[model samples]
Target: QKDGTKERYVYACTPDGTVGRCNKISIRCSEVDEEAWKYVKELMKDQNKVEERLAEIEKKLTSNPVDVTPIDNQIAEIERQQRNCAKAMVTAKDDEYMSQLFQQEAHELAKARREAEKLRADVLRGMDDFQLVRSKLDEFRKRWLDHKTKLEEEPTYTDKRLACSILGLKATLYSAGHLPRYKFTITPPEIEFLILLHRAERQPRPWCVSVPAG
Candidate 1:
């Protein structure tokens, strides 16, 4: 909302006579990073015996051989620690321990996937919002086409199902090149939310169009 073409700016002018904006900040995930890295190192330690040896040998053949002093010390350290794992295996209740480990692993994987999914949804939502306010015509056109095609090819619906599902408003099923291309199913169990969105562009209320029954 600039007044009569008065200047508008995202960032304030800098001392060097240039507009400036800060780079996006990425929040620190130190704890998660450390935990993931530690797990990776532990897993690699178990599997790196032959792989590490081969890599070293290959590097030596192609470039230069690594100094043996440090390599020998690392090998000695690994050999010394190998018995710790062996001792754990020997003293463990294998079945119970493994079952608990498997459950924990699955729980962690699911938690990670959920967290990632939320992040993805957030980013997509943000993009949709930003686009709504400041999208190019080309971008909108492309998405409109995609949505229209999606509608033709797949209309997830039943009687009285509301129209207009929004995909970040990036795409709309009403646009060109996409209309009911094929049949798609709408299942009753798919109603995960009470409020439904659809692909039709009617007013934000239910329409009263007469259904012609055969």
Candidate 2:
């Protein structure tokens, strides 16, 4: 303890305990935790921000239209080649070399067909209909509302963490002009609508503060 004071600091360190890896960066635990919770509360309770996020999700879900016609054509071509190979194989049964060549070609074409079909399916799956998009967005909104209700109550540490997870929150520590600071990053949710996240950049020195939790 410094001067008989029970002081605590949040530290960034290397996994293998390498010297000088973390640049000897640290800050008061209370300071960092307080800053993090502030941002968390802001993000969780801001109804306008929530609506903006939902709008962004809806845009991402419906903005890009996927075309699988090329994939379909590729599959059709592969099938045609397979049919030709099969016919050739029947005629070349007496000739082992020709028969083997046709069989190998047929096998390769079949593999290509499978791959093309899978690509087609993936494209179709990603291209959710308008109704499905609405449903997913509605689900996300409901989840957010539920989380907000929990936040309004006295949320536990687990609840706090769940909020972070739902919002894809991340924390990073670094030095800002000899002062240790934290940066909170929020990535897009992994739920159906894949999109980018808006980050909160705060500092402790002159401009801003940081965010984090235990």
Best candidate, lDDT-wise?
A: 2
Query: Which sections of candidate 1 miss by over 4 Å?
Result: 1-94, 135-214
lDDT of each residue in 75-161, candidate 2, tens digit only:
888888888889999999999999999889988988898889988987886654444545645655565574546544555443343
What is model 2's C-alpha RMSD?
9.9
On residues 1-214, what C-alpha lDDT tens digit does candidate 1 reach at each position?
Answer: 1222222222121323223422221112232223333332333233344244334423433352223454355445545554454455455546777656655655655565466556656546544533332232223224433343332232222211222111111111111132321112222212112122222123222211111122
After best superposition, candidate 1 residue 90: deviation in angstroms?
Answer: 20
Candidate 2 Cα outliers beyond 4 Å, as residue runs: 1-35, 66-70, 121-140, 143-150, 155-168, 175-178, 185-214
> How high is each candidate's TM-score?
0.21, 0.55
Taken over the whole model, the C-alpha lDDT of each candidate is: 0.31, 0.59
Clashes, model 2: 2
